[model samples]
Target chain A: MKKIVLSMVFMAIATLAMAQNATLPQNITIKALDGTSVQTSALQNDGKPMIISFWATWCKPCNRELNTIKEVYEEWQEETGVKLVAISIDDARSANRVKPHVDGNGWEYEVYLDQNQDFKRAMNVVNVPHTFVINGKGEIVWQHTSFVEGSEEELLEVVKKAAAETAE
Target chain B: MKTKQKHLPLLALLLATPFLGNAQGILGGHVTGNIQLDGQISHADSVIGAADVPEKLLMNARADILYTNGNFSAGLRFEAYQNPMLGFNSKYQGQGIANYFAAYNGDKLSVTMGNFYEQFGSGMILRAYEDRYLGVDNSLLGLNVTLRPIEGVTLKALAGKQRYYWEYGNGIVRGIDGEVNFNSIIKSMAESKFRLTMGAGFVSKYEPDQTISYTGNSAFRLKLPLNVGAGAIRADINYGNWSLQAEYAHKGQDPSIMNEFIYREGDALMLNATYSQKGFSANLQAKRVDNMSFKSVRTESGEMLYINYIPAITKQHTYAFLSMYPYATQTTGEMGLQADVMYKIKKETLLGGKYGTDIHLNGAIITGIDTNRIGGDGTLGYTSDWFKTGDLYYADASLEVAKKLSSKLKLTCTYGYQIFNPIVEGHEGNLHHNHILVGDLTWKIDKKNVLRFEAEWMGSDSKYDKNIDDKRCGDWIMGLVEYNFTSAWFVSVSDQYAYRDGVGNYYNISVGYNHGATRLQLGYGKQREGLLCIGGVCRQVPASNGLTFSLTTSF
Candidate 1:
């Protein structure tokens, strides 16, 4: 079984050498802060770049990254017309705390709950603080895992680059 | 063995090659996956009870590959635990394709084959999930189907055997669930301020009969039910800024080893209420679990094969001292309540300063349910009153305040108090009372440079006893400093010392580097023995003086 599985993976790698842009998966449903269902396909910024971050209430690094981004979010929005979407993968144990944590931190990003981590698995995110940059066409253009103090600066650079690409 | 180890990295690289370009391929369907490798090398430490390891090194690695088209998706996970790491089950030493599934998720209908994880109504009566850190994965291997015949209405059905290590359990589990959204289903309520959703689920497990002597009496045999069933009902209501969720579950009588072969039935209840606005929020939760340890095989009595899950109501603290004594939910019989409040003082005020102040307070208390023992085996083992209280199990309260000292610096302070009884972990001791304090500071030195410092102190009333070897006793002090540079590299160093009535001093240092979608970290440290828990499920971790490294990448 192990040999077969390994060969299949290698076959896939051989055929997928050429790269093409991939759109976000549709038909996946998540919950807004108000307990309303939201479709993944509806996550749009009106042809502007969007930043989606996967975080949790218990992850300290994730909180740090979000708080840092919140500091310069307004200025970034003004400059690039970008939107930041925060998804909480808190599950049943701490899902209830996401809203309070976000509000208490004064974060203005659009927040949603992935109680079952369905969206996290769909994005193939292995860990928290994973950030993705999407172009105007809803294609994922850039992505990063983990965060340090100045990673937000790099994130903004990608957003600006994506916005520039879409403008042309 | 060396040759096998060398092939692992090559295999992972081959699996990761397709997504290295950050694009989809293979007939227009996206090929995405993640790879994680964790390794440890440790030496024996008698003072901390770290056992000697004959193997010089141990590693745990896994790779997940997923292929997705418009409405169809397929995925598989390969896991390899070469000689399994400490704190992990030795049964997992071998590795293979642990999980695989194919599914079609469309607008109206969905079907999945092979392994799948699911939860029904807050997972009171049914929750099949995986927590890699806790070494708990109960995903079912079977067929699952979902139907949305109308808007706001969902129906689901599933049948399969639970996964046990690399194999499947003997029992078969079948379940059905339905949910309705009133606002969406009823046109008249579409614009109503009140939003409501109700759901119900029924699950049953069938295990073949086995002959067993009653209470070691060879002449007597006990009758066992071939099928045990459990049902749950839940409601989620939201009105403006107020929200409430409640679920209740009941199980039929089925003598099992977890309950000491008792025929008594089981039940659980959970409630949560919350109100929130822009800058403030409050929440309260309450739960009660009684004889609710439902598993696939009655004879199995470990952390595996649980057919249901009961979440703990206590807050999951992030600070070291604040979470020193983590709470693990008692599925047999326990009651608990938790309250939380968060408020932000306005900026430029007397106490708010220029950037405002954030205040958070949380408290929780748990107690055992009152019960009167009747008899063992072949009889109702115990009787309990619904509204009566028993011994106190655990209680804790904490308050944290944070403020931005400047545009480039931030400060946070916290105070916490806790009382813990060792019986919850199958140990006996007087309740330990502790007081903890923490202070944290962060400075953004520049656009690409940052530094953080943390200090914590814990004072406890419990004394260290050589008989029990509980290292968590006595007073402790910890200090840490971390620096990040170049937006990609970070170095952290920390030490924890038991200043009074303790035996060990643990120190650690680590360096990490990150690139796009990839991270690598290497560290050498002395680890303290304790229970590593996530969401009330816990696994015992032994102390070790070790070198550890991890690599993670996703695309």
Candidate 2:
């Protein structure tokens, strides 16, 4: 009985420390790799369509998925005019590697650093390799966790559907 | 509210546009945002629930607000954790503003003030920040400025008080850092195809420590300097198919509550090299950290108020069993090495017909650093000497292969071997043995609709430590199947079982409908027991019997 009581106390304490939110707050700053400042609003494509991939240098899946997509990114862009933005959540320890990592990988997508994870937390991303698909009007249309070998192909198909609708 | 305000600014900007609404009241600004939610209502179960804590309902939601103008920007977060789920810290049960900050940028001069987050070199000595889901917000509310006096020279200085709990912590903290980026300084170097970037940064902080009590001399109450300093220099050079990077860092005596004894300062080094070409690539990485235990508070919980962030170099798998065991960095002393290689077999070959085949192999190992302690009888040693060798701590090796098989069929197989030590993480000190095999197949039925299947098997050689574990060790198996109907609807069913020795047999079934931007998902599952991590953040998961519902909409 005494052990159960102690465990209950511990459970209460742990649950109380978790902070949850249903929607993102209204204020935050988005900075570019060169440390240049861009209005969060500037990232808007007027709801046409967009893809934001949460990644980190230390995350193997993030590296794998990003490189896999880079191989056919130009084709996706030409087909849908959709811009895929790769956001690096590499904190201070690996933040310095952001530049070289991008250059070495030869990825042509727009890159940003979220060392603080303000954006990641807002998006409720508990892990790297989380991808979000936004429609042309600026709404999160879909989100998928984790990446398999050909998940990029599935993502592109989704983009193609959105593009076909835009043409219609 | 943000979306409502967003249009007015655009409308106003469109009215101002001489050409029309395209640029006018359009108040043209780019907005990128995301939100995630996990909610559950569990039924009372003697084995999973905490008797009185109501095996009832719990939920949490976090959103990031990012607003930026021409040369300046700002962001804030609103979070709520109403009875957060099992195995999570409860202090964040209350709902309110979790984080807020702003910054301004210009040529050679950048200034930021308010509640902000920052990390020093490798976060070895100091890092302040926020993580909404796990309810962690340790931003230092103060002033910060960055000055670039020369083309390649950059300097930064900050002084602030740390945020503890709902308010600020009792301790005051201050720090200054600077770095010179060689690539930025030389325009000619930028023009060269061979990319090279070299830079160095140092950070120092002052936080009074009150726990260092001494008895030898009553008057000599070792007033902790709270003074901690670290320096790091890194270089990246790329020539042809090969690229290399190396970094070295050292920290001076700054005692935080994490490393009890004033034992000694810390030093670390990291190196990475890679080679790539058409259809093939390889990468290698190595790192070592010694005697570096720095924290903000001596008495705080083990993972809280971390002064430095230790980056782990290993692949993080997402499959249920693949992720069952993870390698968390041991900052006090550790040495690690990793290698990864990928090869693609061209089409027309036996394995690759028209699309080709992909094969990959990756391996990593970590060990403890060798050290000899020499110091005072009671107080923390002033200095300790460390050798360049140590014993193996952990290792993970894996091989994977993917084949096209046919136009309509694709298959993938993966095998992994791992060794885990319990001493560093504080659970069980026994060494762990794990072996896993995975296979996946996808059928393109038509194109608009498809079916995917995945099966995995994992076996362990280590038994649970009798001291802490109520149940013994177990072999595990997992399987997943999903069907997609059109572009907006999908359904999946997965099950994980620990039938051999442990007691984690869980089944989950979920279906989601993505109509435009609104997604609704409902799931029923028995959550297994284990540690879960997202974005370098970790939390334990308790076994539970429950139903979960999630609805997310953004415009």
Candidate 3:
């Protein structure tokens, strides 16, 4: 046990020292709302910044986060040409309900299903309500886990930054 | 002492190389991962049926580290359970490198060596995955390969042994799968109204033989198939506004502990259809299974080493009381059906004031298969009727309505009825019928603050008995209030009280903070014991009076 702890401490230090920028993974398979197999590498927002959210139907915080984003999505898109892509990590049992639930909630966002969680594993997402910010180059720039009432505003700031970088 | 000495140099090398890489940032690969640490402090409470915890403090921590450079990547997960918390498997008592893998991805081929997860069509015959919160990780420790020789075609092959606690299971599993998209392959079909895809998979397991004596007659020895194989085929068809999917799987006879060493061949079939437009959608699903409990090891039982997945077709409720009696999938012999519909009322109408109102209706039913034990020892276990259902296992029907009363306020009401049979869990009792109602309200106080409230009530025909340990068979009331401040901090309080035929009050308060990629939460509560399920897979969580803390971060 003591040796294991010592090894863990060394690994932690090694991880901290090797920190660098994050980027989007390629060739992972996910499903569209229509149940078509789509590759994650093909996802694009027409040179605009994009936000990807990992969520599930039974997760309360995930629902809350998406609902909060829906309230200001239009304005955010108009201002920065931003797009939010909501990805559900629901398995086969609940995967069928995702479409109707999205329609009922009246959320105007691109929704996809990660039924088998292949894409989630590739991106190293630990939990739901995890959000990622990708620039126009399709590189992951920022990310945050969990949601609070005002976190959307911070996300908007990151989107604006990515958009500005593209403009430059 | 030998193992410790062997690890010393590796540790020193790991600690020294990072500093060397730090000096040359351009050559250093990008590192990304996440960490989750959960700690619990509990006390014995006789009223709640919580057992006295000798350790008093328990912690579970895991850290994943991935390094990616170009098309090559490697990752490892370190897990530690300093005396696992209640509800977790006691076998996970120590710490080690639980999982590690190296993979290379190219345009046409991908290869992974070491721990990995994979699932075939509908996971009817093969699925190896992990659910951390449930303490279930059945990842395969071996080699997996995926090839895309042409557009819209994917081929996957894997061979491995499943992880069991800290060691690998005693069975070797091998599988191959292939999927093709008809529309994408042919140019003319790309623009056609019909889109079709087909897939098939075959999985086989090999285990060493074990001597088995029949329980009914101890003098008789039973024969067990050393090599068990299962095959599945699936298809998906989509047209304008409509889609359909179906999968069928069949397995050769294999004796296992779950079915009392039955030698019956297993089979499963699942069918789903959906129709959707802008504001309306409908879905129907049906499934049947006969002796379909596929595990990696023949002698293993419980939630570990499962080689296949059987999905329960039921409505997964989100409300507290509505989900009190969540159903568990009966994989051995069962038939189930489910239907769902959703419609939205447009704004500016009688029922839709300023914003639209949404209505959702769902229903599901599951039953046991009609079977007769016809064989003696050392023979096929039973014969089952193909089209007859024996007894009702579970049934549920629910309707939910959500409306936006104002720009800042939203209300949702739900009503549900459920009938559950205790026989599903090997208990002999009358069917329990329950009615549940829930009202939820959310108010956006301003741009930065929000508040939400929920009230729920459940009335049941089954009365709780002190002799019976299940606390869910009773009338109960629950209420919750959550407040959010500055979008970065939140606090919530909730309580559940058994108003009739039961005796217990579960109360909890939690506070949380989130910033960037880090989140921290703390709670103090009295938890009621129940079966916590996710997507039909369940684990028993014991009652506890405790303080809990969780911290998660990613870089």
The candidate that wins on TM-score is 1
In candidate 2, clashing pairs total 63
Q: Cα deviation in Å at residue B34, candidate 2?
A: 4.5
Candidate ranking (lDDT, best to worst): 1, 3, 2
Q: Candidate 2 lDDT, tens digit per residue, A1-168?
A: 433553353243233312221222223334455543333445655445688888876565476578668868888887788998888887654564565567545678788877766566556565556788866765455676555445577788787777666667
RMSD to the hidden true structure, all candidates: 4.4, 9.3, 3.7
TM-score of 1: 0.93
Backbone clash count, each prediction separately: 0, 63, 2
Alpha-carbon local distance difference test for all models: 0.82, 0.63, 0.81
- Candidate 1's residue-wise lDDT over A1-168, tens digit each? 556676776576546622666678887767777666667877999999999999988776788788888879999999899999999988788887787778767789999988766688889887777889999999889888777667788899999999898899
Q: Model 2 fnat?
A: 0.04
Model 2 lDDT per residue over B431-454, tens place: 778899998776767656667788
Question: Candidate 3 — which residues are off by over 4 angstroms?
Answer: A1-19, A104-108, A148-150, B1-28, B216-218, B529-543
Better of 2 and 3 by TM-score: 3
**Candidate 1 lDDT for residue B270:** 92
Q: B402 in model 3: Cα distance from truth in Å?
A: 1.1
Question: Of models 1 and 2, which has the larger lDDT?
Answer: 1
Q: With candidate 1 superimposed using the best TM-score fit, by how many Å does residue B538's alpha carbon deviate from the native?
A: 17
Q: Give lDDT tens digits, candidate 1, residues B54-80.
A: 897988888988777667777778889
